[model samples]
Target chain A: MHKKLFIPGPVDVKEDVLQKMATAMIGHRTKDASKLQRDISEKMMKLFYTENQVLLSTSSGSGLMEAAVRSCTNKRAAVFAVGAFGKRWYDMAIANNVPADLFEVEWGTPTLPEQVEEVLKTGKYDVVTVTHNETSTGIMNPVGEIGEVVKKYPEVIFCVDTVSSAAGAKIEVDKWGIDVCITSTQKALALPPGLAICTISQKAYEAAKKVENRGYYLDLVKLYDYIQKKDHQYPSTPSLSHMFALDYQLDKILAEGLDNRFKRHEEMANYVREWANKHFEVLPEEKYASNTLTNIKNTKDISVKELNERLAMRGYTISNGYGKLKDKTFRIAHMGETTLPEIKELLSNIEDILGL
Target chain B: MHKKLFIPGPVDVKEDVLQKMATAMIGHRTKDASKLQRDISEKMMKLFYTENQVLLSTSSGSGLMEAAVRSCTNKRAAVFAVGAFGKRWYDMAIANNVPADLFEVEWGTPTLPEQVEEVLKTGKYDVVTVTHNETSTGIMNPVGEIGEVVKKYPEVIFCVDTVSSAAGAKIEVDKWGIDVCITSTQKALALPPGLAICTISQKAYEAAKKVENRGYYLDLVKLYDYIQKKDHQYPSTPSLSHMFALDYQLDKILAEGLDNRFKRHEEMANYVREWANKHFEVLPEEKYASNTLTNIKNTKDISVKELNERLAMRGYTISNGYGKLKDKTFRIAHMGETTLPEIKELLSNIEDILGL
Candidate 1:
């Protein structure tokens, strides 16, 4: 059965986008590859809203997260955790032996500017990692506000993971002073789950130069050097199939206009949120709800597993809550090429199944 | 123009294999994904001829290479370099801050078993990295012989990169006593250039348990644990498109019969080698020449650049020597789904172009 993906990621890729994955292979060292990579980087720069060097990796967003924390954290790192994905950054720091401290807020809460300001006041950390959109909690941290605070600590490299929100939300990487902004192809980019894309500021690259043991495969310095040295080619073979689809999708996205795309996501979020408000309570604080996916409290005490099973029988599937939040909460993701009508159909199906 | 890749990797994928990549996306956290992953792992175990665990990564083979050296090397590493790819392992060790030493023979020369014995006799290393096939030099190292030598040093973790040779050559991971054997999708696996696959022994897993700083994304221990915990899912989202193709292609490769596939590759290698011997000398020693890709010395001093240009015009592409060997030698890959007729055609085209 073709169950539509309403999960946080590996969401519903368009048929056309999926077809692009079948594009014939090309030599990684060829001019065709260099051109393809260069084009993708250029398009990604526009999507990321930054002039920083855009890089691609043939791994999940976690790979880039590890790279940023390991490469840019020359002295120490202060990792802020709003939910699961945020906590992952701190884990990545520890795993790579990058000295770091983690600060956590309540699960459904956001990472506030005041908290970031207090952390930066220590001045001991050289890097700070933030989750722009916490998929686990459906909480979009006030990164713009946090960026304002982070800007005050010029020495601290600012890294933001917009994995679940990059294209759906407006993240002005340059204006927001984000030294390293990371995202994967499966999220708001509306592509398959292979390629990881990120932008590295000059500051982050310089910081990486001072950091030793950055590791070869995910080393930001080596990645950056290779791109600069050989046009946009990577140090190792990349997923050219993903790159081909990405290049095509980015064109379609730009044609739709960034503003229009963001509005579409907002419209879908508003619709989903309004439905949840009537049937159940939203998990995250209303002021900071995610535009890409919504986590709803199981106010009716419904079995999420059973709900998903019912949903799947009807040719659709939504996610049970992440980790500890499972069963207590269920999620409805509306990002990445999911149309307003599709979202409505999904919600209506849910309503019918629940006898609401 | 549709240039058929005669390069070492990112080789020409069959249309059916490419179509598999176009398969619909699925939620990474779902049971469907687990089943898909489990199926791939089980099939991969057969392909690897190992009872040990098979893990997949969304990056290139180099990713797993880094993982093995970084995760399994606790005390120190002795990296034996026969060519560019071999040296990359040593570089990965240094980049990850793993204590290591590089033992390099001349570019086209093979790593002798005696050299490995001498290194193991030192008793200073806990990990040893070798290349099963060096793409750059067109040299397939005597890993079977070297494996025999390595077996004597029971405590040393043996890592082999079979990137360009895995599916085309017969590598009995269990019989060879290899702790970690890595290969990628684009090589003899004949998929695309994204996914990396490897088998890890219990000894390597235990060694990894004691090693610190096995960064999150490529952490072999985390990958193995996750597979065990979740029944074959990865720690992060994988390249599902590549997985789809790999699952399908593995069936095809197996249906062709591993013995038949090996014999086929050997046939192609013999035909190409004989042709090369007639026109020019093979780069590597004849006994050590690779059965997948053969590097031919530019003995006639013809313009390799011009030859490739002519070949490209006729919808074919071969590689010049890697890095410093460029123009001084050229490579013709006969691995993956490449057949005898295609090899004959490519050779015939080269003859017409070179007037040989």
Candidate 2:
């Protein structure tokens, strides 16, 4: 089926991005390969709103998220969970055997500054994790406010999962004092899956050095060391194809203007939220709603499976509520290269199918 | 500035392979993504000489090797090291906190069947790892003979790293009792770096079930379970761009014929070895020399780095010996999609530069 993805991630990719991926291979150790990586990192630094170095990995964003927690959390980690992705941080911590404490909020609720402040007051952790746009609940956490709370505890490494929020929303890594800010290509970046990019502060690097057994491949210190030594290249072989596509896509993103791109996402989210408010309920509070995607409460007692079936027949597909919220809500992602017209079209089709 | 790599890995990639990587991006969750992955895996099965399931990971071969060891080693791992990469298996195990023992052989020496038998006879391990081709020393282990030794312990999972030898060497995965055969693109496969492929048996999957804390991203059991559920797709977003190139490149490889490719590699290795022996000395014994690359002894007391610098001036790059052998020896990688004509030209250039 030639269905367009309206899901939270692995969203519809542009043909140009795909074409960039198919570019001929090059020697990874060659100047051409370094040029490709260097270009991607420089552009990625701009996208992440950081002047710090950008590191690329071939794994999904979660890998780096895991790397961040494992690498930087020498004492303990205070992981705040607003939704599924936040929970994933705790899971990643436990799986890597990193000592961490989980702070869970209700599914549709966002992580608040006060909650983070309360946790930071404890001073028991050297690292903290926050998920910036939780795809499962469509809650965009108040990371900017939380950043204020975290900055007071400079010893604590602030790691943000900007996987779904980065390109759709603003995340000024340096400005917000986030030590490690991670994002993946498959999300709002609108590139293919499999590659992740992050910016690590000097503080994060220091914290990583203290941690032991931070396994190879995802070893943050080793990666940072290699980049410093090799002039922006990764220690291991990188996904050159993805780097090519990313370099091209960043130009498109920047040409659209970063603020303009953020606004487009907001515009799409607003359109979907308004439409859902009239027909059903928006899952997250209007004050905490995500700019990248909207979660619609199934107030009309509608079957999402049936709605999706109808949507699929029309050559479009959105996602159901994730994990515990599967039937109670559904999600519509408006991130990445998706345009205003595409969003309107998907909404109209959903409305027609739902008879709203 | 137009330097060609002959460094065992990150080999000189063909223009077509690079071109394929420039393919347009597609949604990873879409049918297109599934098709690409399925196609790559099916083609990879042919490359590994197995009907077993092929899993694609957006990591270097080391990542998958770590995954295999971490996931499959429930009791203990008996890692046999012929060179650096073989020692890497033990490193991964120790780093992951997995119980493992190393059976070391001298550098540039092939792992013997008797050494494997001695270790397995202890019955202290449920997993064993061996590197088919050790890039650091140019030793190709006797995997077939070692396979017979491992077969005695049916409960023990056999993992092989063919990072530098996969496509250039014939590895009958099932026939050789290899529960996990790991390989990456950039080497014998002659694609760009970034992606690694592995063939996994049911036993390996079952073994991973008992091992806790396999870690996210490289969790082999999770990967296997997710693929079974998602039509060969990964739990994490994969590197679709690499797959696009890999699919196209695999077709080219198959078109050239696997046996013919192996023969070409052997001929190149023999040619390089003979030339190096006549000029200086062959590092490994004739019986143990790699079919993928040749390590040359620095009998002339020549500076390997200086020789490489001289070669670089002529637009070619060969590797100096790694680790302790850094200045004592040098290496010429004959693997990847390198043709005999290209190898002959590279050798002739070396001769011209060295005036030997």
Worst 10-residue stretch by lDDT in candidate 1 chain B?
Answer: B27-36
Top DockQ model: 1
DockQ agreement of candidate 1 with the native complex:
0.89
User: For each candidate, what is the lDDT?
Assistant: 0.92, 0.86
Chain A of model 2 scored by TM-score: 0.98
Candidate 1, after superposition: displacement of residue B25 in Å? 1.0
Residues B1-356 of candidate 1: C-alpha lDDT, one tens digit per residue: 78998999899899999999989888887777888888888888887789999899999999999999999998999999999999999999999889999999999999999999998998999999999999999999989899999999889999999999999999999998988999999988888899999999999999999998888999999999999998778888998888888889989999999999999999999999999999999999789999999999999999889999999999999999998899899999999999999999999999988888
RMSD of each: 0.9, 2.8
- lDDT, residue A152, model 2: 91
> Estimated TM-score per prediction?
0.99, 0.92
- For model 1, which pairs clash? none
Q: Give the DockQ-based CAPRI class for model 2.
A: medium
Which candidate ranks first by lDDT, i.e. highest?
1
TM-score of chain B of each: 0.99, 0.98
